[model samples]
Target: MELIKLGERTFCADGPFKVGVYILKEADGYSEVCIIDTGVDEAAAREIDEALVKAGFRVSLILNTHYHADHSGGNRYFIEKYGCKAYSQKINAAMISNYDICPSVVWGGNPVKEVLNNYFYAPPCEAYDISELEMPEGLSIIEIPGHCIEMFAVKTADEVYFLGDGVVSVDTLKGHKLIYVYDIDKQLESLELMKGLKGKVFVPYHGGITEDISKLAEANISVMKENIELILDICTTPKCLDDIISEVFDRYGYKLTMYKYAVEGGVIRAYVTYLYNKGELVAVKEDNYIRWKKA
Candidate 1:
């Protein structure tokens, strides 16, 4: 992982999955070094620790934007090393502290041994509920849920916003074709909210930092709308969930692995829920099979 200094107060540890961990430099030395998100495991945390040391800052606190392994996997390492306080949104704090709940929720049932691996679940760590605390100085926690249950964006006084999977990069959208969202309705609303953000720079977890993210936000919304329409078209014949998933994947020619299957299932289910709630689709029982059809 390469740590690129973004500003006097901001630094990014660039890796396969980038994380924003900012430091507050003081005249005497460094006052507090705050971690926005940890990478997948201790390995990522090691790099972050190195970056902190190089910047002459003592680790003060670690904040998780959500409970996903890629975002909070280094919680144990940071907490054990610095004895720092960890904080996250209420729902995410509860899940990260437990750990098992993440994979369980992802698989929609008790996860098998394969799904319990570090890729799906990280080591448990304690986190304070951020909703209970007053907003920290020089930082504003913006709720940007939907990609995960309680994902948030952190805006620093430096005018850089650490967007936690709130708005995906254009390249990610083009390559993956479909992004994950637990709540499609909220995800769409979050995308719209992101459009009005005013900041000097935006740092996406998986994308490069940029001054403007409006184009990327628009691209993400376009993909969601396209996929919803595709699913709606396929549901004209009262298809089952698996059928809708298959049709969409086949149309996009996306090969699936066990992990991808689980992730995509949640994404498809979100679209289904949105359509059902909007009265654009309805669930039907035919021949003991549950299917969805146009309302």
Candidate 2:
């Protein structure tokens, strides 16, 4: 399909990028265009350009909303083919560009889903060597470290906050009683920042967009706070990282070994860290296992 125009200079594409692309239509020609979030592979990359060609917009600069493979996967292809500059958050530069970062571990992140479900896919990206640039106008980023080390959201002029995964859409939130945010506290804080937003709409990449983001923010916060309390209650003894993880997952009726795999070790530690930071819990070093006692 051609451009799914959202505004005078903006458009969105599907399948590749999932939700779509944000096109800054070039006034000069096709060469001056700015695109935010290139979709998955070479095929998606080509379609983005082809659609631009059809719309008479030239591709010039490409900005990755974050370093996730799904968002920046096409950066290398775009820069190599179009000579467009590639950009991402300064913090994630090494992780996304290094060849050693095998992101496949992030999927089927829970062991329960890993055993019950066999859904898997190859890691679709290689290192993308983008000459980084600062974020552009109408695209301010706030560090949301829970989802990953360097997660952020891109806000547009339309009062639409293109939050990557800081929060899921309300539609997806409707059925699930518990939401699996790796860093529950930071995710909560991120949602807090979003709660203050005057923006009437939110466009998260994964589960589609939402309107009146304040409402979704409220629901997510309420449910998550309750989950945290429940997890704390279940912690009769301090267990190893994996044991705690498994315990928490099983409580939610989730198999820790399935669906998704890479739950952040540092972030998991951060969950306890958050509780400690909040003065609600205390951690004591035991000989073999760390004992966490609620204060």
Candidate 3:
């Protein structure tokens, strides 16, 4: 992983997943580093540690945007090795400390063995409530919820924004037709919020950094609307949730897997709730099955 400097003190480890690193100089002639998000596992954390060590920095704090495994998976490593202070929103902090809650929530119950891998369950790590953390000078947190519950975007004094899955790149949108969204309505609101943000550089977790994020935000909004419309069309004929999931996955050429069924299935359920609340779709319970149809 290459550590690319964004500002005087802001740097990012650019790799499969961008990890934000900010340096704060202490009075005792020591430089303490803050990590924005840990990557998928211990290996990713090791790479980050090596990169930061070679750059003459040591991790002292970790701020997880949310409790997804890919973002919080390395929390255990950092906390164990460096004794780093970790923080996230209250619920996310709880889930981070109890990693199994992640897969259980995604699966809507106790997840099976197939869904309990590193992708869903990170090694457990303790985290405090973000609200309780004392803010360092020039570091601020922005609440950007949509992709996940209580997700945050970190802004440095240098005006660099580390957007935590707020908006995805056009290439990512094209590659993965369906992006996971916890709340479709809130996701749209967060995208609108991002357009008005002033930043020297914006770093999205899954995409490259850019000076301007307006176009990227618009691209994500467009894809979200398209998914909403597609789901509505699929409901033109009354269909059960399973049918909708199958049709949506097949249309996007996604192979059926237990993992996708849990993750992507949750995304579909979010759409269903969004459309139902908007009065665009109606649910009918018949013969012990609930089916949805266009209103």
* Reference-based TM-score of each model: 0.95, 0.75, 0.96
2 against 3, candidate with superior TM-score: 3
What lDDT tens digits, residue by residue, belong to model 1 across residues 1-295?
A: 5677776677777876667767644536655778788888999888877776776767777778888888888888988988888899998899888998888887788875667767558878788899776766777888998888788999888888889888878877877877878898888899899887898888998876788778778888999999989999999989999888888888988987677778787689889989999999999998999899988
The window of 10 residues in a row where model 2 has the poorest summed lDDT is 115-124
lDDT of each residue in 1-295, candidate 2, tens digit only:
5565554444565443443344454465443566766666556677777776776766667665566656666666777877777665664555556523424334323333332211112233333333344545555555665665557776655555667666766666665544545566678878888878776457666655566777777887886776567547755555555666666666666654323235433334556667767877677687866766566
Order by lDDT, highest first: 3, 1, 2
The lowest-lDDT stretch of 10 consecutive residues in candidate 3 is: 23-32
Candidate 3 residue-wise lDDT, 166-252, digit = tens:
887788898786788989999999999998898899999987688889988988899889888889999999999999999999888
Alpha-carbon RMSD, each predicted model: 1.6, 4.9, 1.3
Question: Model-by-model lDDT, in order?
Answer: 0.82, 0.58, 0.89
The RMSD (Cα, Å) of candidate 3 is: 1.3
- The count of residue-pair clashes in candidate 3 stands at 0
